[model samples]
Target: MKTFLFRSIIGIFFGAFLAVLFTNAIVIFEGRETLDGALFIKNSIGSILCGWFSAVSPLYFEIPSLKLSQQTALHFVTLFILYFLLAFGIGWIPFTWNSFFITVLIFIVFYLIIWTCFYLYFRQQAKKLNAELTNLQR
Candidate 1:
């Protein structure tokens, strides 16, 4: 429970940070004259909620399995649903087949990038631990 809440809070802040940065960039790029304060507020809240909901998958491990692929699948599925809701429910993306398809492609690309980073981080940590154990044995 504590882990879940902690992770969720972290997600909330991180998501909001990214939201601000991305939205602002888009606004600037599009040459928008003025920012809609209400829209920004609504979108930020939605993003925070998105983070809260999506963070559960990474911190959750009730299955007691050792299969990395299975764990990754579960995580991806959970995130897919969460992101779909965030996009379609919050009007972040249009309600069209083309939009949905593009959203899915974006999700896949980001998921793979994030997963690869995590995998590399874990591998590095494991290597460090193995080295430490080897040194202790000597």
Candidate 2:
């Protein structure tokens, strides 16, 4: 129960972080502007959703004694397919392949960063939890 709670909290945090980072980057680099309140809300939701999705994936999902090489390969393949499909899908939406491709590229990079940060944060938390468990056991 405690582990589940911890994971949930981590997922939420990662989601918020990802949303804000991407929204801000878009504003700065793409010269895009959105209404303050709406933008904030949208970004917050987006980040959380993406964060949750990533956390749920096997790559980011927590598991003990997982084989690093296999996990990494799996992550790479999944992400590659996901990004490609997403980009193509977005292009299909508006019939704008070039624009969608560029957007996907940007999103991919940002998502990668967010994933790394969340993963590290969860890892550290897990380490702390393990230590506490060990101490309690001792």
Candidate 3:
């Protein structure tokens, strides 16, 4: 519980940071000085929630009965729902079918990319541990 709380706090900060960074970039690109207070607050809150969920979503994998595939699918679906609803509510994406479809595509692409990177990294770590174990047995 303590570890979870610590991670949640970190996630909230990280999420807020990313929200500010992205908002700033958009403002600059659009030749605007700043976002309005309400929009800023909404985005901040949404980002924080998203971040918190992202950090804790890995707990799904801790279920011993769940296969890796099941864990991954569940995580992906929940995250997709959370992000899609938040993004739509925060006005990050337009309220149109086309916009929603495009956003979904983008989300899937990024999610797969990140998932693949982590998978490869952990797979490499597992291989290294196996090698070390073999060396120890020799």
User: How does each model score on lDDT?
Assistant: 0.83, 0.65, 0.89
After the best TM-score superposition of candidate 1, give how far the Cα of residue 102 lies from its true spot, in angstroms. Answer: 1.9
Give the per-residue lDDT of model 3 (tens digit) for 13-110: 98999888988888889998766888788888998888988987877877899999999999999898888888888888999999999989999999
Pick by TM-score: 1 or 2, better one = 1
User: Could you tell me every candidate's TM-score relative to the true structure?
Assistant: 0.81, 0.42, 0.88
Give the distance in Å from residue 88's predicted Cα in candidate 1 to where it truly belongs: 0.6
Per-residue lDDT of model 1, residues 3-115, tens digit only: 87788888888879878887889789998878888888888888888867777678533567647778888788887887787778889999999989998998899989988
Indicate the residue-level lDDT of 5 in model 3: 87
How does residue 2 of candidate 3 score in lDDT? 82
- On TM-score, the stronger of 2 and 3 is 3
Candidate 3 ranges with C-alpha deviation above 4 Å: 23-31
> Using alpha carbons, what is the TM-score of model 2?
0.42
Clashing residue pairs for model 1: none
CA shift at 25, candidate 2, in angstroms? 19
